[model samples]
Target: MKSPKQQSGDAAERRAETLLTGRGLTTVDRNYRCKGGEIDLIMRDGDSLVFVEVRLRRHKDFGGSLSSIDQRKQRRLIIAAQHYLQRQRWQGPCRFDVVGFDGSHEANWIKDAFSA
Candidate 1:
């Protein structure tokens, strides 16, 4: 059985996919993983390659969902993205995006959330 966290992640990915698609982004990959780390979603937004991190939180007691993706997480994502590109031999324009979700309060799409 999948852990609760895993299940939550899956749901978040699904929501993120729908949201991105609604905004005209085409999903290329979901849960792209490597030795470095994992990328929640990889998509194409117009001519740019988009690497998205999907975050979900039940409430904003400590901090909002987006705030959870801090510097350390960003570094890991960057490393993972590099690994993905190296393996795919991808040489194109890319940007990192964060899709933050907290129940029923509009999902926030933070584009170029971090640098590679």
Candidate 2:
């Protein structure tokens, strides 16, 4: 059984997926895991592949949800994305995005949040 924290995270991912799909992005994969790291959501926006990281914070303390993804986290995400691309043989355009949820606040979607 999933712990409450894990369940909450799943719900957050679902919310992020819904928000992205509402904006015309289609889901490619979810919770993709490899040895290096895991990707929360893989989506397609137009001809570009999108690697999204979803973060949920109950409070805006210590920089909040968006600030949680620091350089180390970004590196892990990049590593995971590369692994995915190699497995899928994807050579087309791709970008990283971040979806942050702070308590009951609206979602904050940051496109091209980082480069590989």
Index of the highest-TM-score prediction = 2
| Candidate closest to the true structure, highest lDDT | 2
Q: On residues 20-45, what C-alpha lDDT tens digit does candidate 2 reach at each position?
A: 99999999999999999999999999
lDDT of 2 at 2: 98
**TM agreement with the true structure for every prediction:** 0.94, 0.99
* Candidate 1 similarity to native, TM-score: 0.94
lDDT of each: 0.91, 0.97
lDDT of 2: 0.97
